[model samples]
Each structure stands twice: as structure tokens, then as C-alpha cells.
Target: MTQSIFDKFQYYANLREDVARLDTNPFNVVVEQVLSETEAIVNGRRTILAGTNNYLGLTFDPRCIAAGRKALEEEGTGTTGSRMANGTYAGHLALERELADFFGLPSSIVFSTGYIANLGILSTIPGPSDVVLLDADSHASIYDGCRLGSAEVIRFRHNDPGDLDKRLKRLGTKAESALIVVEGIYSMIGDQAPLQEIVEVKRRHGAYLLVDEAHSLGVLGEHGRGLVEQAGVQEDVDFIVGTFSKSLGAIGGFCVSKWKELENVRYAMRPYIFTASSSPSIIASTRVALHILREQGAELRKRLWDNAHRLYLGLRELDFKLGPESSPVVAITLGESKEQALEIWHDLLDKGVYVNLVMPPASPGAGCLLRCSLSSAHSAVQIDAIIDAFRSLRNNILES
Candidate 1:
């Protein structure tokens, strides 16, 4: 008997059937209308968007809109070619320069999305002779990138610098030239990596370091440069990969480096070579959004942190299991019970709030996660309303 290729999806198909029987689907949520930065019409009802990773909430910013509109009108829709071809618009080069300037780095490469940035760099930089050491709980993009490369890949315990040191020691001479990858702030649990400690481990091992600041950009540091600037280890970090989708409220990713040799990697990266470049509108809006993040980021960070703390503290008072620290991403851990998690997630949405529902394989552990990412644009009343919704759940089903 031969196995069908469709046999692989049986488990997921069964899981989908189970969710469908519940009369609600967490994965198929549709926004009927985007009411504001914090509110949207979903399931034919007004819903508070607590799950969106819009850290700085510049999606509705007039300045960004105007810039995008101007670019759309003048440059038309898209570049319609790869960066090495007709896609390399004036805006693309200008944005790359601006990004390098923002990070105080010498060179930068822009990709269409954050996932591609990781894929292009991770797959291209480390060769067959090199080794890639990453956190065990890294995002799927990181894992896929390593698989795409010829380098030997190893996983260290998540955020465990000691484990990283041990692995590097085991590699002997190869450790010196290895690449160590970690995120500034992990997406799942909203916990930040101990960059100062990780940097020390990298230095001790003589390895190159790459920090993905996708979730931390515009959320950390005095100037919102992410954990690198906050830990004062910018000079030690070899590469800083980040996305404009979060804080900048645009769809693009970039990798900025102090080493001039990164400029040479552009030619070797297949992901960069084959993929179409970002549209002029995206680059223009991203540039304007980056400017906003630089100039007015302090106030925005304060508000964002305030909302994060407010949500964290409120959930803690209700005795719900949460991530270790209070950050923009607040995850409520529901132990290994998909049914209960699904119930709670559906309830929250029905109560006029929408959050991310993460399950096993995707979540960090055996548990499921009801992750809520707060936005700077969310008002105090909106925060309280979200809390109130959770409180109602605890009272109605959780506590009982």
C-alpha cells in the first residue's frame, strides 16, 4: 500500500473539523471593517484589536498615509521586478540608506517582508563550513532558514546563555566562526532576550551575533532601537534584523550591519535575488513611519508600556497564568487543553475583544496561549474593557 501525499494533513483536517463543530474558528477570523487603530468590526460586531502587533499604531497616521498616497500616485503600484533588476527604485536605495543611518550601521539590505529577511540572511551567510546556533523556541522562519542553508544547525535552551556557551565549547575551533541567532524580544511569550549576557557568551566564544528585533523595534531602549541599544551592546552585535510592520506600521524588513562585507551577501542571496522588491508606496510610508518612530517614539513607548503593565497587572490580579515579565505581548497560558482554550478564545471574541489563539507546536510549550499584544493607540478605557471581558470570563467559567 502506498501513502497518499494528502495523508499528511489528516491530523490538521480532523482538528479543523473539531473546531468547526464548535461553531467558531479562531484561524478564520475576518475583519469586516477596520474602525480604528484599536477597534475593528469582526464577526459583525465591534471588536478591540488586542492581538495586532501594531506597537506604535502608525497605521492611521496622516503623515504616513500622505507619503504612501504620493508615492502610489507618482510611482504607480509596484516595482514589478527584483532588486537586482528594475525593482531597485530610488526609494529602495534611499530607504536602505535611511535604515542604515537609523541603526548607525554602515550597510543595510531591505527585503519584502520580515520572514524573508531572516530567510535571505540566515540561508546565505552561513556556508557548509559554518555552524548556526539558535534558540530552541525560535520562530519558524529562523528554523526554515537554517534548513535552507548548508551549515550545521544547533539549538540552545531558550534564553540560556550557559547552554549556548556549552555548545560553542563542544564545537572547538568551529565555534569562532559560528553564527548565533536570537530575538531581541520573542514573539510568543513577549519576553526579551538577555542581550548583555548573550553578547558576553558570543564574545567569549568568538562568534558572530544576529539579533532579530522584529517585536522589540520601537518598543525598547531610550530611542526605541530595541534591546541592543538598551543593553548598550550595539557595537558588539554583527547584524540587527527588524521589520517595519510592527512599530513602523508598514510591510517590510531590513538587516543592518556594521561590517561592510554584508554588502557582498546581496549578490549571493537567492531570496533577495528572485523576490520582487517592495513597492514605492511601502518604502515611502515606511520611511515616514521610521521618522515618526525616531522623533515621537519616546512618548509612544511610555504609553505602550503603560498599557502592557496595565494588562499584565490586571490579568495577574485575576490569578491567570502569564508570561514571566510584562511586555507588549501578554500571553495567558492554558495548560494543554485545546477545547478550553478554544472556548475562552471564542468567548473573548464574542465579548468584543480579539486576541491571538496559539496552540501546541506553535506555542512555546505543551500549553495553549491566548496572546494579547497591546498597542500605543489603545486608550485606558479600551484597556479596562479588555480586562473586564477577561474578568467576566473568569467569573463565568474560569473560577467556577
Candidate 2:
């Protein structure tokens, strides 16, 4: 055989073998049909959707769908170019203005996706002389952003504001040049950052602070502005990055900042300069969803929380491991062994419940997670059904 460049695929093949020869590939759960925001068809079975991040459940809202249809009929399809090219349409600008107004920030820039927003900002802002102090459990997009930038990256203990403070102190003179980045609500374990303490620490170090509210937006604060507002530290945060995919029920991302200079990021960031802009339908749907997210968000948030509490308490009562006090994302930790975790995931699927099965590289800790993200559209009966399904699999999970 000729020396092959495809030799690297062997590692993936062996890793597949590690998961008990892949009789049930959790990664291959194909959605045959989407019934609603909280239900889908998989494997010819109508499965309860407990894994999606549709917190506000606006995906199938009549108004949002109407707006999307209007845009599709009127604008055809994509913008077909980058923001720097022929892509900055009027709707894009309008959405940016609306987002800045909602957050009460001075400036905002929309990106092709939530991931791109992080990549563009991180790669462009910090250079060789700068530093990024991040949480150990920061999202992959955040980590990839650091890799793209010229900054010196440092991670402290997860959820430890004290450790972050110590790391900043060790930076000494470089502390002033450091950018402290954290998420409002960590997606992996559904835990929150001690933002108040972290903000105080950054203020003491004379460093900048950026908060990614991807999971917290439309799920926290009185009006759902996110955890930065919930903690009453909006003034202390220099920048915020969030997604339209989660709560807004559309696909796009944005970065709003108190500093108006963020507008200049477009000129320097390659991701924004090179990628195609979001379509008219996406932008149109997102704008209407944003409005609904503002007006009806309180009621939706109430429903979401109620469902989350029910599922969390139900699982806990069943003597299963759970994430630290739930909000919307309820992560049930499985065993340290990958085989056991896979078994639990497959069992739940067989019971007509669909949840996110997270393992190494994606999960926060060494253990795997059966992460359930509740939605506002999940009815009380649906919640009961999900709980019952999990209860039915208790024997398998506990025994495994």
C-alpha cells in the first residue's frame, strides 16, 4: 500500500470501537420530521425534544413564520456575500440597531453566526502583546478564537472567581492589557459565573471584560436582557456576544458593546470580512422574534423555568445525578466510564425521549452528560411524559 495521507482516520475508527462497537450511535439520531418546537420524529417515532436550546420556543410562532415567509417570497434567499461586500442590507442594519437598543448599548455588529461573532472579535482585538484570561470550561468557539488571535491565553479554575483574581494578580503589569472573558451561563453544566466578583476583579486590574450570554439571553434578567443585566453589572461589561439561534428562533450572531469603536471590528476581522451574511428570511424572522422576545419573554421564561424545575426535581427524586440547581439546561451526569454513559443515552432514546448526549471534548468534566434543555413551548403533559420516560429507564441507568 502507498503511504496514505488518510492514515489519521484510524484514530477516529478506534475511538468508534471504544464506544461498544456502535450498536446505538447517539450521534446518528436523524430527525425524520419536526412536529413542533419541543417534539420531533426520529426513527419513525415521535420523540419529545428535551435537548434543544429553544428557550423561548419561538421557532414555530405564527408571527415569526409569517415574517420568514414574507422575506422568502420578497427577497428570494441569501445575501450571497460578506458584510464588507454587498451583504449589509437594510434589514441587517435595522436588526443591529434594535439589538443595541434592547441591550441599551451604544453599538452592535451582527455576524454570520454566534460562533463567528466570537472568532472575529477575539482574533482581531488581542495581538501579540495582549492576554486573554478565560474560564477552564469556556466554549469551543471561545477557545478557537484565542487560537486565532496573537494573545497569550490563560485559564483558571472553572467557576472560581478567587482563582481568576489570583491569575490576574500574577499577570502584574500585563494585567492592564488582559481581556477577561466569561460566559453568563455555562452551557455544559448549566452553571452561572460569579460575574459580580469577576467584574470587580477586572475593574481592580484595569482590564477589559467580555461576557458571552449565548445561553443566558432570553432566559435571565427581568426583561431577559441576560445575566449581565441580572447581576446589575451592565456598566462594567465592555462587550457582549450572543446568538439568534437559541432564543430568537433564527440563525445569526451579534456583538454589542458600550464602546462605539466596536464598529471598526468589521474592517479588521477576517471572519466578518470573508463570510456570507445571513439571509433576508433569517434576519427578518430574527427581528420579529426579538420583538416577541422582549414583549412576551416574561411569560415564556416562566413556562421554561417551570418545565426545567419539574424535570430537574423529577430526575433528582429518581436518585439520578443532576446539574447544579437548574435554570433551563438540566445536565444529568453519567458514569466516568464511556460505555455506561452510552448505555444511559441509548436507553432514554428508546423510551421516546431525545436529549443531548455529550462526552469527552464537549462535556465540561471527565464524566459524560445527558443534557436536557427545556423550552417554553413544552406543555405540562409533555414535561410529565419526559419525566416518565426517564423514570422508566432508571433501572438501566442506575444498574449500568
TM of each candidate vs. truth: 0.98, 0.97
Question: Candidate 1: misplaced stretches above 4 Å?
Answer: 395-400
Stretches > 4 Å off in candidate 2: 1-3, 18-24
For residues 1-400, write the lDDT of model 2, one tens digit per residue: 7878978799767667866565557877788899999898877788999988999999999999999899989987988998898999999999999999999999999998999999999988988999999999999999999999899999989979899989999989999989999998899888898999998898899999999999999999999999999999999999999999999988889999999898877789998898999999999999999999889999999999998898889888998878778779998887777777877787777778999999887998787888999899999898899889888888866665
Give the Å error, residue 80, model 1: 0.8
* Alpha-carbon deviation at 135 in model 2, angstroms: 0.5
lDDT of each: 0.93, 0.90
- Model 1, position 180, has a per-residue lDDT of 96
